[model samples]
Target: QQQVRQSSQSLTVWEGETAILNCSYENSAFDYFPWYQQFPGEGPALLIAIRSVSDKKEDGRFTIFFNKREKNLSLHIKDSQPGDSATYFCAASPNYNVLYFGSGTKLTVEP
Candidate 1:
């Protein structure tokens, strides 16, 4: 079974609005979670990350909310803009190496 999973296939949000992307994982050994964003034709880039010791992580307009007990997490994009439109992936790593990625969620930010 896949260790990481993303529930939404796509999400749409107007400019300046917030977009929420949900994800879950099955491995308790997974401790580090990172969200990656990829523009069309470009490779995924690490956007933000959170550790099991922290429930929340924020970087600029991106934030991650993690639930260690539920083995789930969510990425929140604030003040979303058209440039923020991309395919977002939720990834996890147990030993800080060999990441397992979710199916990904396509986020379209409309002006």
Candidate 2:
């Protein structure tokens, strides 16, 4: 069964604007949420993450807004750039090691 879901398969944003990627999960047991960013020919890297206990997490230009009660989250990329174009995956885990991923959202930052 698919435990995670991304609302859009692709998203486009103009440079300097904010790009939002949305995700939701089925299992309430999923406590850790991590968003991974992948560029062409490169493996997905951990972009940012949030625990169930917190409503949000931020790292540099990336921010994850989480809603525990709703079981949904959104990743916001501030000041979108052409170099930020990539596929983003939203993943969840009961523990840190094992992750269930959503169908990725391809982000296009137009310059």
Model 2 lDDT per residue over 1-111, tens place: 789999899999999999999999999999999999999999999888899999989999999999988999999999999999999999999965789999999999999
* Model 1 lDDT tens row, 18-96: 9999999999999999999999999999899999999999999999999999999999999999999999999999986
Where in model 2 is the C-alpha error above 4 Å?
none
lDDT of each: 0.95, 0.95
| The candidate that achieves the highest TM-score relative to the unseen native structure | 1
Q: In model 1, how large is the Cα lDDT of residue 53?
A: 95
Q: List the residue pairs that clash in candidate 1.
A: none
lDDT, residue 61, model 2: 91
Cα misplacement distance, residue 110 of candidate 1 (Å): 1.0
* Residue 63 in model 2: lDDT: 92
